[model samples]
Target chain A: MNLFKIVTKNMRQRALATTLTGISVALAVALTVAIVHIKRGMQQRFEQSTLGYEMVIGAKGSPLQLVLNTVFNLDISPGNIPWTLVEKLQADRRVKAAVPFSVGDNYRGFRIIGTTGAFGETFGYKLAEGRWFTCSIEALRDAFKEALEHSQERIAKEKGDAPAKPAAHHHNAAEAVIGATVAQETGLRVGQKFIAAHGVEVSPNAEEHTDNPWTITGILAPTGTAVDRGLYINLDSFYHIEGHEVRDAPKDNDPDPGQVSAIALKLRSPIHAFPIYREINDGEEAMAAFPAVEVRKLFAIVGNIDRILLAQAILIGLVAGVAIAVSIYNSMSERRREIAILRALGARRGTIFAIVVLEAVAICAAGAVAGVAGGHLIVMVANAALRHVSGFTVAPLTMEVAELWVVAGSVALGALAGIGPAWRAYRTEVAENLAPTS
Target chain B: MNDAVLSLREVRKSYREADGNRLDVIQVGQFELAAGDQIALVGSSGSGKSTLLNLIAGILLPDAGVVCVNGTDITQLPEAKRDRFRAGNIGYVFQSFNLLQGFTALENVRLGQMFGNGTGDAVELLKKVDLAHRLHHKPRALSVGEQQRVAIARALVNAPALVLADEPTGSLDAANGTAVLELLRQVCTEGRHTLLMVTHDPAVMRHFERVVRLEELR
Candidate 1:
């Protein structure tokens, strides 16, 4: 019989053990594949979530927190700097574009960012269904009307939204431009008006801007990550909705005056980020945060988790290797007579050795087949689920160069497993084995 | 002296006991067989008769001696060369029939042929064995007499210059054993190939042209 037929027949005879070994290899392979997919997914998300500004300028706080508040719409502001200081930074020769953002308002948990046209361009944000506002008055009407539409649509959709429109408008009254997730989640439509609800209950008077309604004018495109949760507006619209101008109106009509939360600065080069950030934050009241640096730090914080999972994969792979070894070791006992027969039939020791070792290779190949199949199945299921839930598609477990190394490594392990018993068979004495004791 | 197909010169072999003393299996001895010769080695238990056959087949190395098969000094050749030489010129039939379990009788015979024999026409060899009908039958399905016949066909398929049969009919009944032994003698006679058979049955030895009896190992 051919070597492949012999090995497969043997495995079929011991059906249960072979299946158990195959499944063991499969489980190990599945775990490795899943962990690798997650790591890659997180890396891409982390990078996308930090795109836009070359440098973020704020009050003296953690650079990471400054980036989180301004770029990611998470945590608190880096504390505010005076409006005049932002004006000076905006005037700098290296600054190509600048947009100020004042955070702290939330419409059903999506952060409201009061910004300018430069902010939309800075984040590469484009209207999936509507247009961007250019003038200050247009920005104000856009923010106010959009917020109302967002809240109203969320309630009407009965999925995610604000309660009935609030009564008063304050610092939180600025309009809301729905993120792609918010629009899809709440089924919001353009022109709907809604309130910007506050989430920080610790500050009961913190976001009392219900009187200023924001109308939903546009929805942003999905960027595959957290940006799908962002809300946009303009700085002057926020102050107008907050009644800051209404209460202290001058005798004559004039432009609304107030300080923005912070200004996002874009530099000429990514390499210029650190130097410009250091210069901006050095001895000044305002601090500058680099998105790239903060993302790198975040990656460093969670780097060991991936390594731990990888270590577990290696451990399971080793265990599967041992199971393969035991299979060969046990088979040697059953095949002793057959081996002796072959020897008597003129098979040299080397031929016997080759056949036994080939059996081991055949078994490992079975394990590899099982592992790759099981691993692919898990990746496919994960991809389908992620696509449905987050609208972000996960790439299937690719047969990378590294995986080839793993297969070669397992084959080497299989060889080691068979060497002991196959060598014993090779050295057997044909005369003694075939001698008639009776 | 006339082109001895198989020869042994001063062959010796021994086994070591747990107590460090030696139990000699076979002392130094010499023997030779010519083409068309039918010889039987008859002995009691543990008489080293099988060891001599193994030496001739190049399956075992004598402690000290020379073995030549088909005029080539097999004992002096390296292990690989010796195996090649054996596969090229020597064929063996064991008492157990020694057919691979998973393969059919014909496949077993073909396997033997592949290792340097059976390079010629296969249909001719099947016709000679008279096993043409039973070619597809596995060893387990075949009766003891039938299995022995298959083994004989395998040994002769390569058309080796010499054939070694160890108790080829040991497991058969009277009629079957006689039929198998007669088949072996008739095939070797027709092909002019040398036959060296080791057996315990005196009745079977009568068919041999020469009979060598060993009282003890030497």
Candidate 2:
């Protein structure tokens, strides 16, 4: 009896067109929602991971690579910088903490990073269970000396020279602290032992270090960041692995047989950052990069792709609007008699026009509401793939204010699309159309 | 005349032929229908009997003249006001029973009541037409007799002062047509509403006490 009822009747009368157009709107909205959600989530996770890591110093190469490698446990490390650079940054007055990391191993595809006990304390990371792995400056220095001797003996044997008899070495039990996700995935408890794969990612032919198995001494609490996906081992134990021998040339008297993949720096004050960055970049030893700035730059590049995706979504929406317009306009031919009947029954031309317009609006409004729900469902399903690619998943159920605007925009689009058809209905000749056809 | 429920003065209607000549459809000097009058205006095919009914219902505006219904000149009213006036004062029934196919019988009658702002019970009106059990049936599902009865219920739902029936029984078989015509006339007589029915059927014309030819009105 109401205009709304009339519109529902009209829409029900054209259910196929209604459903098809509605699905098109839902498709556009779903894609847009997924894009916006994943973008926001990745940006937030990247920013959060960079919180304690004000600066990352690595081998002279892409700064984004260094941040991704050091802070996010993503992309492979560019190369190693000499350990003397870590010592220098640690001793600097402007540096509050400088934690070195070495990577070249994985346990079932989760990266195994060798770092000091200071990593957890410096970054405010907490142990969920058990204890930190045994790691100290003295142990690191002694391990470096042993690695230098091992390399020297290899060089002598390769050169067909008489190799000196190696001194007796004390075997230290290698220990590791697993990340939350690492523990959950590998089912590694405090007392469990795990051997490392020789590469960052799992490969069928990847070599496993069965000889250098590490005991899990601790598990980290979930920080909702890249830390959850990393396995931390003692830096001293890292040098004891055969392939991880020091690459520096031995000086014999003061053999600098130590190198690290990356060093994360926490500045005493942000004002001292640029000077320290310049100091590191100026030296041939390493390059210094701000993690936050690098993250922003990375997303800035990604934003263009997001914009293109958003443009496609908008284009779909516009096409849907036009389809609605064309569809309702086409239906006006069949509706002339109905319109004439309504007019003959004392309904005004304006009332007939409103009925046509309201029908379109109702269709879009229904589609938009269904689209929002379908969008959230897309987000939920996409989160698994997102976690695989980025170690982060956007919260699917969280609503954005922009979604309200999306619904409103679709309703407005419906109204605009209805204008031509409504005008056609308004201008229909009542008396002529009402005449019975054979 | 003072108590007339329907009045027409100097009413003229015309259409331009496809070949550019003007064709006059209706030219009536003056006509009046008193309250409760059941008059049949008979005309042959294409004689503009339907056109005259449309003019009275305010569905088609006269090219020249005044159309007064219930003492108010509907021709002088704006299109919107005239529509509202038509809804309140005039009821129209077409030969084909133009009920919206999407709606049930009850909803179709309520649709008329909605535009007229009438508070009459639509169920009561359908019950009067002996369609109480068929209130939920769509036009296509109903027999021709039931469809015309639904149309009659819709026309009188607002209890308007004048009812216009253009070949109201034209599309039905004789048996159903006679039954629908009697039901329509009974309802109109009971409500004391003035009825102006257009028909070419002699059987239908005999049912009316007063039959006016379209030419005689001109």
Candidate 3:
């Protein structure tokens, strides 16, 4: 009896067209929503992961690759820096804390990072199960001296000379702390022991360091960052593994020849960051980069692809709008009799016009609601691939204010698309159209 | 004529042919029907019988005259006002029934009532037309006679001062047509509403006490 009832009846009469057109709108909206949502989610996650890391020092290479390797645990390290530089940074008055990490192995696809006992405390990572593993500067220096002796023996043996017996390095127990996801996926508990496999990624042909097994000492709480996906082990225990000797042996009475993949620095003051970054990058041994700036540059390059995808989604939305207009416009001819009948029942022309427009709006409004839900589902499914690629997954359930604008834009699109057909219904001649057609 | 429920004077309507010739359809100088009167208006096909009815309902405007339902000159009102005026003051029944196919019988009647601000009970009116059992049936599901009966109930829903029916039973069989005609005349008499029905069939004219030819009105 009401105008809404009339519009509903009209939509029901043409249910197939209504449904097909509605799904098209939903498809466009879902794509647009997923793109906007994932882009923002991933950017937030990437940026949030860099919060405490003021600067990262690595081998001279792409600053982006260094950040990706150090901050996110994705991509291979550019190269290595000497452990003396780590000791130097640690001794600096301007440097607050310098946590060095050496990466060259994995256990069941999860990377095993060799770091000091200060790592968890420096990064504010909380333990969920056991205490942190024991490591000290003295144990690390002994491991380095022992590695140097081994390198010398290998060199003497290669030259057909009887090699000197290398001094055995005295180090702490080979203990490890596991990230939340690593422990869950590997089922490695606090007392469990696991062997390291050569290389940072999983491979069947990769050699396993079976002779040097590290016992798990702790499991970290879920941080919703790359920290949740790693297996950290004592750096001194890492040096005891075979084939880990420093390749570039230092001369007698030289500084420690030990090498590490990278060092993450926390500044003593905000003002000290620029001077220290310039000082490190100016040197020939290593390069320093701000993790935050490198991430911005990376996404700036990646933002182009995001823009292109968003444009395609918008184009699809425009096509859907046109399809709605054409579908309803074509229906006006068949509905002239119905419109005339309503007129004969004394419905105003404006009322008839509103009915047609409302029908279009109803179709789109329904599609938009369904599209928002579908968009969230797309994010939930995409989180797996995102995790595998970046070692970080965006939070899937959080809603953005832009989603409200998307729904509103869709409703406005429906209104624009309905105008042409509504005008046709308004102009129908009551007397000429009242008669029945064959 | 002051008590006349329907009146038309010096009314003229014409259409322009594809060749640009003006073809006159209605040229009635005077016509008046009092309240409670039941009159059958007869004309040959294409002789403007429905045209005059449309003019009276304000569904079509005459080229040059006034159509008064009660005392208001509908031709003087703007198109929107005329539309509102028609909703409350007039009722129309078409030959083809003109029922929306998607709506049930009761819904169709309710649609009519919605526009005219009617207060009558649609179910009771359908029951009066012997369609209480078929109230929920859509037009496609109803027999032709039942559809015409629903149309009749819709026309009287607003209790208009003037009711115009153009071939109300033209699509029905002889027996159903007679029953529909009896129901229409009985309802008009009971409600004290004036009825003007247009049809070429003499069988339909026989039911009315006063029959007017289109030529005589002109």
Task: Write down the TM-score of every candidate.
Answer: 0.77, 0.96, 0.96
- Weakest 10 consecutive residues of candidate 2 chain A by summed lDDT: A246-255
**How does chain A of every candidate compare to the true chain A by TM-score?**
0.73, 0.95, 0.97
Q: Look at candidate 3 and give me any clashing residue pairs.
A: none
What TM-score does structure 1 among the candidates reach? 0.77
Candidate 2 structure quality by residue, lDDT tens digits, B63-165: 9998889999888889999888888889898899999999999999999988999888899999999999999999999998899999899899889999999
What is the model-wide C-alpha lDDT for candidate 2?
0.90
Q: Place model 1 in a CAPRI quality band.
A: acceptable
Per-residue CA lDDT of model 3 for B56-161, tens digit only, reads: 9899999998788899899998888888888888888888999999999999999999999999899999999999999999999999989999998998899988
Candidate 2 Cα errors over 4 Å, as ranges: A168-173
Model 3, residue A208: distance off in Å is 0.8
| Interface Cα RMSD, each model | 2.8, 0.9, 0.8
lDDT of each structure?
Answer: 0.71, 0.90, 0.90
Instruction: Give the per-residue lDDT digits (tens) of candidate 2, residues A201-297.
Output: 8898999999999999999999989999999999999988887876635677754778899999988999999999998898887999999999999
- Deviation in angstroms for A203 in model 1? 19
Candidate 2: how many backbone clashes? Answer: 0
- Give one digit per residue, the lDDT tens place, for model 3 in A61-117: 999999999988889999999998998999999998999999889988788999997
